[model samples]
Target: QSEDDVKTHKGEDQSEDHIGACRGENNFERIPVAVSCAEKPYKCSECSYSSKSSSYMKLHLLTHSDNRPYKCSECSYSCKSSGNLNKHMSTHSDEKPYKCSECNYTCKWPGVLKKHEVIHSFDKPYECYVCNYKCKTSSCLKTHIRIHTGERPFKCSECNFSCVTSGNLKIHLRSHTGEKPYKCSECNYSARTSGELTRHKVTHSLDRPYKCSECNYSCKLARDLNCHLRIHTGEKPYKCRECNYCCTQSGHLIRHMRMHTGEKPFKCVECNFSTSQSGDLKRHMKIHTGEKPYKCSECDYSCIKAGTLLRHMKTHWRKAKLI
Candidate 1:
């Protein structure tokens, strides 16, 4: 047919094809034909449903009723289509549905699998108009926009603790309830978050997968690699507001601030002694318990503090020096 004739037919059938059809966004193809001839090239025998592709009609047939032909022998799970049955089988087989080509990472859900695949690709499709902040996915760019706008939609009902990401909010909620859902199977040790549990599991293994580019330094966790990178970059992002002091770690800056404020949060209940640090409080508690944890291998000498044991060992070093 001519190009003009095709356009005329398409315009005439556009309204007819959309009468009982899925919206333009939902459907992949919009085959617009003349109204009288728009009964679809392919029609379903069971229903008024019609599609240009038989595959689309086949999908619709599955939703007609709960008549699942494909069944899983391991479980009560069944599906109308073989494709869905294959996806369901992955659950019982202990296999990930989608795996990344670049890494050993795998995920059960397709949406999560797609997100994982983006990390391997160099494409950054989404970008912020305000700051030119680029992200691999649109969802990530949307979250990044919140940082510039200061739009914290996710808020905790317990307090004024607000965050940009939903994952951060989820991890924050565990703090209030003291919930440790991720547990180590090798030991009784559990963690508040999966990332913490993953780090704990690395202690059991000697393997350090993440390595630094600038130095020979390697670490078990990606976060440790990031922290090591900062040492080479000399990027002390964490700074004490009270003083000119800056640190690679936020924890170090927090402790430095405490020295200035004299805010000793950790207090010894038995005595008037208080400390700005948890480690100092722990050592103080050992005084009440008479716990001599540190010991010298060369002598039978033991001490409450590790520093005290090290000082005691210096006497033996001096004796060797005299000889």
Candidate 2:
């Protein structure tokens, strides 16, 4: 057949086999007539990748190999393809083409934009088996399940500390490293996590939205207000397994459990003095520094702790027959 006849066939059948036949007489002989006339004939054996173009198939094959020809100029990021390298370059820039219509959220990638869009939707497919808690993503549901299971998969190598999430574990590691990446804008206060910095920032603001009905107690967060309410109600929800001791806060329960387990996690760097509570360790350090922060108003006497100063004031009250 003439070249004009092949062009007519190309315009009629846009199949890969028809395109192969139009290439050369040898190409027409190589491709079998019985072969499937699929648009994406070039398939990768390594993965479920298939492409209509041979160049796209070759690029897909590079993903299966260790060869990274594309390198970023701004960073040490290297990718197997130019397309992926172009995506990596966005991290160096403030440009976000994909934006959410529902919110002020903007992302560099379309996949991330799609993920953010799910938050606007009322559909929460992922639900917890143990609780009524529901989330948009399966990963969120998996993290929420840890609360019921008491499973702490993320563990620290420096200490026996373990947390429900890897993000919490990462923040815990910063405590050992003394790395405070998040800083408060209002003060010189710094924290290991952004959440901690956010909470600290609230202290600078005079606006206390959460208030107690029982008393004049007020806080920045609803969780803090809930905790403060326990003081008026005398609700000790957190209980000890070994003893009848209970506390209103989970941290208090954790410290109380240490007494039964004989676990003194907080230790002094200057000496061999150790304690279960961090406040106890701080008070113990004062013995080394000879720092008496608590002072008596009635006398020239000063003490390391406020409790000691209070006891000392009681002696003057007894002298005046005030008791």
Best by the lDDT measure: 2
- lDDT (10s digit) by residue, model 1, range 209-316: 999888899989887897889888888755554556767764575567667766675667688888888899999999899989899999888889888998999999
Question: Runs in model 1 with CA error above 4 Å?
Answer: 1-179, 269-272
Weakest 10 consecutive residues, lDDT, candidate 1? 23-32
Question: Which pairs of residues clash in candidate 1, taking residues 3 or more apart in a chain or in different chains?
Answer: none
Give candidate 2's error at residue 180 in angstroms: 0.9
Looking at model 2, the pairs that clash are none
Model 2: residues >4 Å from true position, as ranges?
A: 1-153, 213-216, 229-248
- Candidate 2's residue-wise lDDT over 180-279, tens digit each? 6555667788777656877988878889999999989888987899899988988775556566776777567666666766777677879888888889
